[model samples]
Target chain A: MPFVTFLDYAGVAVFAATGALAASRKELDIIGFLFLASVTGIGGGTFRDLILGIPVFWVINRDYVWICASVAVLVFLTAHRFESRYKLLLWLDAVGISAFSVMGAAKGLVVTGSVSVAIITGMLTATFGGILRDLLAGEPSVLLRPEIYVTATLIGAAVYTGADIAGLAPLLASILGFVAAFIVRGGALRFGWTFPAYKGRPGRHPDDIP
Target chain B: MPFVTFLDYAGVAVFAATGALAASRKELDIIGFLFLASVTGIGGGTFRDLILGIPVFWVINRDYVWICASVAVLVFLTAHRFESRYKLLLWLDAVGISAFSVMGAAKGLVVTGSVSVAIITGMLTATFGGILRDLLAGEPSVLLRPEIYVTATLIGAAVYTGADIAGLAPLLASILGFVAAFIVRGGALRFGWTFPAYKGRPGRHPDDIP
Candidate 1:
């Protein structure tokens, strides 16, 4: 299998595990774990495919679904074995997002031939799954955080698309994209790097209003 | 335009208005209103198209986007005019969902040629937009409610698809579907109809668990 394809599957597996863990927090049934896992792992890519007017990746290929189900079941059974599981999960999730972002941009570039749209596709592909997961779990979404999460995806997409446009090999451009996203996300995870929240009068906290 | 086409646009308009109202509650800016409105109007249909491996509706026809944006701007400017706006909004949303469910199933049949898949497409098309709206607005999702929201959509979809399969005329079948969904939702709205929650011993409330 090609390297990019391998990274896609690996990213999906780790993301599925994260979804299963989140489902456990809500005391959802076994079916919920499977459902959440499948959605979370592929949600971003599904959105990307839809916007690009292509067949969703997992529809024609059931292997992705099997991988997600396997990861979810594994997480469900052995969740208690690992200490500091949530922390580890976050780092793994960062890796998954990076992989997804690069792949998403590459796909977008191929489909649309527009770097700006491709960059947005990368950001959406990186973040939308976790957004869907939090929504399903009824938790506050990471999008609400004043973090550099989406920005990292943007940087990765832009770098990759720029390099590709500069006539670099697809493999090298993809590696650069993945490395850029991983570095930014790692900084955020390890050093708590975040963007400043909007503090203007119109952007007042909802609680402060009522 | 065909009657079904008109219902689709009407549904999109009303749903977009509801999304704008939701955004206003969070004090989101005008741009937020537009974003939420667009998502709320077409979110379900987009999912349906994606799953059926068809091109998304809005991307091909910019008219849908224009309608959603127009509704959002109208709602954002006049949200405070009514004293019981949310109550009115719920009734309007019910109408939109009913219309969307019928049309979605009809389109699904055209694309997938399976009544069962079409029924599911109807349900997703009716409820998913509101679900997306609530998630983006950081509010408690309607899916968590015991009320007959999704059930109403399911009823409409099943009724319509069944009628269509029974050789009913397309327009009549669609009308039956819309009426069925609207009645259930309207009844729930007026009488506070809801389902009983499962009160399992081991699966107690999350707050009560710890």
Candidate 2:
């Protein structure tokens, strides 16, 4: 349980860093960095807890907010030192996603005793934060992109849920899920892996065809 | 109480229509239209309930989902016939925001006896759905616009909260709030009222100055 808590904190910190990097790209002020970081760090878990009808984790404990705010401040002071902040953001986001996917599924299983819901919570926890970040930053959403981001989270969540259902040890199952997600997301980052984007055909609309 | 319930349903329907209009502009499929409409319709209330640690209203009732889905389908069928869909969308959005602002504040007051929380929840309920709609549709978010959108919601919420604190009747307070929000929003739609946007100053970076 302590290890899982550590993973959660690490995921939040890394996600906050990515949000701060995005704020920097937008030339936002310090308040903007703090807002984006806090939102991206907590958005996914908040969504999961809401769906599960549980008290929000951050509201019960304020440490998460402090962690996100601290990371935002650190990133604001030092982000300019990076040669390619975008590259750093991608790497950090991969780590955050892998960590959150396992932790979210574990929490869901404990709360709901349902495998399918656990898998979904895992996916939501891993991806919703980044979605909110992009929305607030006015950047393209990862959901709309061709990249293999969501697929990676889905695979991770499924593997974790399956392992848990098969009675694997908790830590082992978490490791398996984290590794699965990281491998897929890392591959996409390194090799530009992508699914084919939808293309509109020139044919008449279905409702329009007489 | 029944009137409040009616207001909630009407707000959801109007918000869903705006979301479907956005999906049509994006040339999305039927599934996409349904998804966007449902998200935009129930999103703000979901946020409110989650923060209040109450059961999500839609998950409990299910009628909200039906209303949103029905509105989406209806708009999808007849939207093309409108000569100025954008104008129609704006008017409907004004109505939706106004109703939601009052309802959100009232719910917040009932759940938590804190006036500040009530005002904040009201603002969230009124604006968050439209923000999500714009983000998903890849349109510039109303938050990024100079329009008096959030201001209208804030004012409406504050007025409602104040009236309730002054021992006004619930129905009367709600009407006052809704009318206040609608008048401001409607004015913005009819005549281009906007706050001045922030302008970046040309100066040396604060951290870089020696």
Candidate 3:
């Protein structure tokens, strides 16, 4: 349980770093960086906890906020040195999604005892943060992209939920889930893997519809 | 209490109608309309309940989802007949924000007993649904629009919280809050009221920095 907690914090920190980097790109102030980082770090877990009808993870414990703030400040000061902050962000996000997806699934399984909800919570926890980050920052949303982002999280979540339901040890199940997510996301980053974009057929004219 | 519940359902229906209309503008199918409507209807309250550490209302009742779905279907069938769906959407949104802001503040006060939190929850409840709808529908977010949206919600929430704290009757306080929100939003819609947007200074060039 302590180890899982560590993974959660690690995931938060990595996500916060990405958020700060995003703010840096936008030339947002320190306060903006802190706000973005904190939201991106905790937003996913908050959504998952809410859906599970549990106390929000950050409300009871101030540590998560501090961690996000610290990561924000750190990234704010150091991000200018990086030649390719976008690449760094993608890698960090992959790590975050890997850790968070498994942890979210575990928490969902514990709370709901439903495999479907567990997998969904995992996907929500992994992707909602980035989605919020993009929306708030006025950047193009990750969901709009054709890349395999949520798909990676979904696969990892399903794997973890399946493993736990099948009586696999918790730690082993987590590792398998994390590796699966990371591999898929990493492949997308490295080789530009993507699902085919949806192409809607032309709509009938209103006059022709009748 | 029953009256407040009625207000909540009414607010949800109005919000869902706007969401479905947005889908119509985008030429989305019925399923897309349903998805957008449901999210726009319950998203804010869901956020409120989660933040308050209470069970999500829709998860417990299911009636909220039914309301959203039903509204979506109605809007899908009837929206094309409207001459200016955007105008109707704006007016309905105003009504929604008015009712939801007061109700959200009332819920927050009852649960947390914090005036500031109550006001914040009210604003979140009023605006978050619209934000989610715009994000999902790939439309320009209302938050990005300079019109006095959240400001109106804030005023309404503060008024309700102040009235409740000052020993005003619940029904009277809610009416005052709702009226305040609607008037402000109505003014914005009629007159195009807006707050001045932020304009950041040019950053120091890295190479020129000592």
Candidate 4:
């Protein structure tokens, strides 16, 4: 439990830094940096908790907020040192999503005892915060892209939940899930791997059909 | 409770219709319409519930899902009859936001006994679904516009919670809250009222400072 918890904090810190970087790019104030960081850090877990009808994790534990705030402040102070802010955001986001998806799946399984819900929770945990961050920045969301972001989370979550269900220890299952998600996402980041866009002829517009 | 419940249902129905309309504009399938409708109908309340660490209203009661689905189906079948899709969306959204805001403030007050939290809950309930709906449809959110949307919700929520804190009966406070929100929002819709955008020089860019 301690090991997984450590990973969760690490992931949240990285996620918070990415959010703060985004805020800096937008020329937002320190308050904006903190807001974006906190939301990006906990938004996915919050969504998972809400959908699964459990207590929100952050409200139950204030440590997450503190960690996010600290990370945001650090990012705010050190942003100018980054050589390539975009690359940092991408890599950090990849690692954060990898860890968060596994954690989300583990919690979902514990709470709901349903594989499908766990998988959905994992995907949401990985992607929803980034989606919200993009929305806040008025940028196109990763969900709208051809990149295999959500797919990576799905694969990792499925692997972790399946391994746990098959009697592997929780820590080992988490590690396996994290590694799998990180590999796929990291590969995509490095190689521009993506899902193929729809190639078929467009359907008649709904207005035309009506 | 009955009156509040009725208002909740009405707000959900209107919100669902707006979501279905967004799906239609995207040329999404029936499943898309259902997904968008359900999310838009319950998303805001869900946010409020999560923030307040309370049970989500829809999870506790399944009727909300049914109502959203029914509204989506109706919208899907009858969308072509509307004289102007955008106008219908705007008017329905206005009504939905007004009702949802008041309901959110009332519930927040009941649950937390904090006027500030209640006001925040109200604003979130009024605006979050629309924000998410725009995100799903890949459009600029209403929050980014210089319209009087969130302002109206804030005004209404503040009035409701303030009135409640002033010892008004719950029902009377709610009526006053609802009427106050609806009138402000409706006036904005009718007269194009908007908050003035920032007219002063922008602050120094963060990068420009030492």
Top-lDDT structure, candidate number = 3
Tens-place lDDT per residue, model 3, A86-186, is 66877898999988998899899999999999999999999999988887778667676556898889988988889888898887788888889999998
Candidate 1 lDDT, B1-210, residue by residue in tens: 777898899899999988877766655556556667877998888888887888777656668878988988887777766555556567778998999899889989888889889889999899899888877877667777656898889899899899999999888888899999999999987887887756764467888876
The digit string of per-residue lDDT tens for model 4 on B39-96 reads 9999998888878887789999999999999999998899888888877888899889
Of the true interface contacts, the fraction found in model 1 is 0.10
- How would the docking of model 1 be graded? incorrect
| Cα TM-score of candidate 3 | 0.61
| Shift of residue B77 alpha carbon in model 4, Å | 25
Model 3, B25-142: lDDT tens digits are 9999999999999999999999898798888999999999999999999999999999998889889999999989998999988987877668767887998899888889888876
**How does each model score on lDDT?**
0.80, 0.84, 0.84, 0.81
Provide DockQ values for all models, in the order shown. Answer: 0.10, 0.09, 0.10, 0.10
- Name the regions of candidate 3 deviating beyond 4 angstroms: A1-38, A48-53, A58-128, A141-210, B1-3, B29-32, B59-66, B201-210
What are the per-residue Cα lDDT tens digits for candidate 2 across A81-183? Answer: 7766667877898999998998888899999999889989999999999998888877667676556898888888888889989998878888899899999
List of chain B TM-scores, one per candidate:
0.93, 0.92, 0.92, 0.92
What fraction of the native interface does candidate 2 get right in terms of contacts?
0.06
Q: Per TM-score, what order, best first? A: 1, 3, 2, 4
lDDT of 1 at A28: 80
User: How many residue pairs clash in all the candidates, one count each?
Assistant: 0, 0, 0, 0
Please provide TM-scores, in order, for all candidate models, with all chains considered together: 0.61, 0.60, 0.61, 0.59
DockQ of 3: 0.10
Each prediction's fraction of true contacts recovered: 0.10, 0.06, 0.08, 0.08
